[model samples]
Target: MRTWLRHHQYAFLVALRRLKVQPFSSLSNLLVIALTLAVPVLGASILLAAQPVVREIPTSPEMTVFMKQNSTLEQAQAFSQAVGKEFQAELANVRLVSKEQALKQLQSNPSWTDALGALPSNPLPHAIVLTLHETPDLVTRADSLAKTLQTRDGVDSVLLDSEWVQRLAAILSFIRIGLWILMAGVGVVVIATVFNTVRLQALNQREEIAVARLVGATEAFVRRPFLYMGALTGLLASALACGLALLALTPLNKALSSLAQSYGVQLTLSLPEFSLLLTAAILVAILGALAARWSVTRSTQY
Candidate 1:
């Protein structure tokens, strides 16, 4: 076991020496791999940052029924329950936002606090918000519900402010799908880049591989160094890709923080993102190297 380990370690060392032989060429290839890997890393990070924000967005179309300023929480709750029951099938969720609850929620956001502070008392009225399911006739059903609620006793007005929300949600869904497709395509590019690099390197050593085979060296013996080189390249490129992706977070958060703060969210990427990208890079690099095994075998056989 010790002998086997020592020989493999020697092969890895040989692979390291091969890369050092042409430092410029090796670095250029490594940079190519790094750039290829960076695409997915950046895409995944963007998706990760956006996921929480997207989930927090209330996408279900909502019909807000504002009650008279004098309406009590008890009356609002009773009205909410009645409306919820009336459209149980069409409604995904229904909640009563009392004047106090609404004001308290608004105060939690810094952006609203300044404006709210100027008011002598909470200006928010008691309200029932009906969250409707996304269906073919969502606008129709919500519009009909809003019209019905507008005429209800004690209800001051009805606002159907969710059509745009649903449209935004649909657009986001399409963008998410497009991003996933883009990530997958870039991932393929990384693998292909690795495969071609290893293949070219193996071909460069064809004469050495053929000579070793003549000395009774097995295919495994000749292939080990190439495999090690591929793995090392993967590790290096992954590290570079991880670094670039992490570095991007600074500017990304800088822009995102300013925007996110307005929405009461602290958006930032951390070390976990580094670890995730590194792991992915290693796997992709290894896969690409392993994929070149047949090419190495073909070269050695000659």
Candidate 2:
């Protein structure tokens, strides 16, 4: 165990020295890895930040059950209660809006006031607004309920108010899928970059490796420093990527808060969770190191 620890310490020091020897090349490789990794990291952070905003949107499927013009308020209220009882599991709320109340609401809105005043009689009908519980199948459930309401004698029309929400959900799904693909592609690029970098280092130290092999050095001993170099490269790159992500998000965070304020919603850009970021960085480093080791082993074998 002591020997193993000593070898690892030596390998780590050698890796550090190798990076310092060619600072320009090392910095360039680090920058490339950092920039590539930052794309996905920043995307993931933005998605997390936007998740709360999306959930806060009043996009739960709702049905506006317009009653027949001749329907009495008592009948509308009775119908609403019946519907609420029937869909108890899915119904969030059911409220009856009398025709007069609907007209008053329209009059209060400047956009509808002009059109409403021109009418000789209130053309609005009683409505039962059915807010449904938020679920993955909310749109389908709302449509089913709407169909059931349409068959009732007093229900003139049932309009679902979730089409736009459905569209927004679809858009978000597509964006998430695209980000996953992008992240996967960037991961492959990182591994390839590290492999090439380590391969070049192996070539540069050809004489030293040959002498070590000639002196009875084990394969593990021969490859340890190269593996360490790859790991160090990945670790530094991840740190740089995180710094860049934070720097880039700072101004955007301020802009988003301002926009949220305008919409009367409290919004902030969320940073990537520390544990998740650390795990990802370590995994990436290990992957790069393994790739480099494989490439170096193959090269040295020849």
Candidate 3:
């Protein structure tokens, strides 16, 4: 174990020295890798930040049954009671808002004073609002209930208030799928970037590799330093990427914070998330190095 550790330590030392040899070139490679990685990392962070807000939104389906202008509060209440009795299993909460109550609510709101005051009589109809029990069949159930309501006595119209919420959910789902695709593409780009970096380094040192093989150095032994090189490159690039993301977020959040604050949420990356991103970066970088295996091997003496 001690011998193996020493070998690995030597290989890592060599890798670090190789990275330091041309500071400008290495820094440029790191920056390129960092920028490529930043795209998906920032996208993922934004998606995760939006999750809490999405969860806070009330997506439960609702139905509002408006009564005729001539319908009395007693009729609306009786219908509400009937709905509660008949669809108790499908219903979560049911409330009847009488026309007088709605008018009083509008009256309470000072903004409606002039428009409402001009009316000789209250124009609002009694409304029975149904909040359905959440189910996979919620839309189907709401449609069934709506059809039934439209046929009932004194019901002016049944309005279903579920489509927009469902549409919003669908939109978010599409965006999530799109984000995953973006991540996959970014991963490929990461591997390619690292692969090219390792390949170029290997080509530059091909003569040395050939001489090492002549000295009886096995491929694994020769490859260790390069592997460490790729992994370290990836690790450093990812760290830079995270820093870049945070820097980009500072200005972005300054703009989004006021808008997001209006909705009660924060849009910052968490500690665990940084750890996760770093792990991803290192793994991808290592893959890139391993992919450049042929480049580091000398098939014929150079």
Query: How do all models score by TM-score?
Result: 0.66, 0.81, 0.79
Off by over 4 Å in 1: 58-61, 64-172, 262-264, 270-275
Error of 2 at 128 (Å): 3.1
Residue-level lDDT of model 3, residues 1-302, one tens digit each, is 99899989999999999999989988998898788777777777777776776677777678999999998888888989998999999888999888888999999998998899999998999999999988888788888889988998888899888667667777778888987897678667666766776777887888888888889988788888887887788789888888888788777778888887886776654323756876787677666566545445433234
Indicate the TM-score of model 3: 0.79
Q: After superposition, how far is residue 21 of candidate 1 from its true place, in Å?
A: 0.9
lDDT of 2 at 68: 94
Model 1 scores a C-alpha lDDT of 0.78
Number of the predicted model whose TM-score against the real structure is largest: 2
Deviation in Å, model 3, residue 144 alpha carbon: 5.2
Global CA lDDT computed for model 3: 0.80
Judging by lDDT against the true structure, name the best candidate. 2
Q: Taking the tens digit of each residue's C-alpha lDDT, what string does model 1 give over 21-90?
A: 9899889877887777676677666666666766787655877889999888889988899888888998
Model 2: lDDT equals 0.87
Query: Each candidate: how many clashes?
Result: 0, 0, 0
Give the better candidate number (2 or 3) by lDDT.
Answer: 2
Clashes of 3: 0
lDDT of 2 by residue, 1-302 (tens): 99999999999999999999999999999999999988888888878877777787776567799999999989988888888898899988988889999899889999998898898998989999988888877667777778888998988998888677667778878889988898788788778988888888898888989999999999999999999999888899999999998898989888888888998988777568999889989988997798789879877875
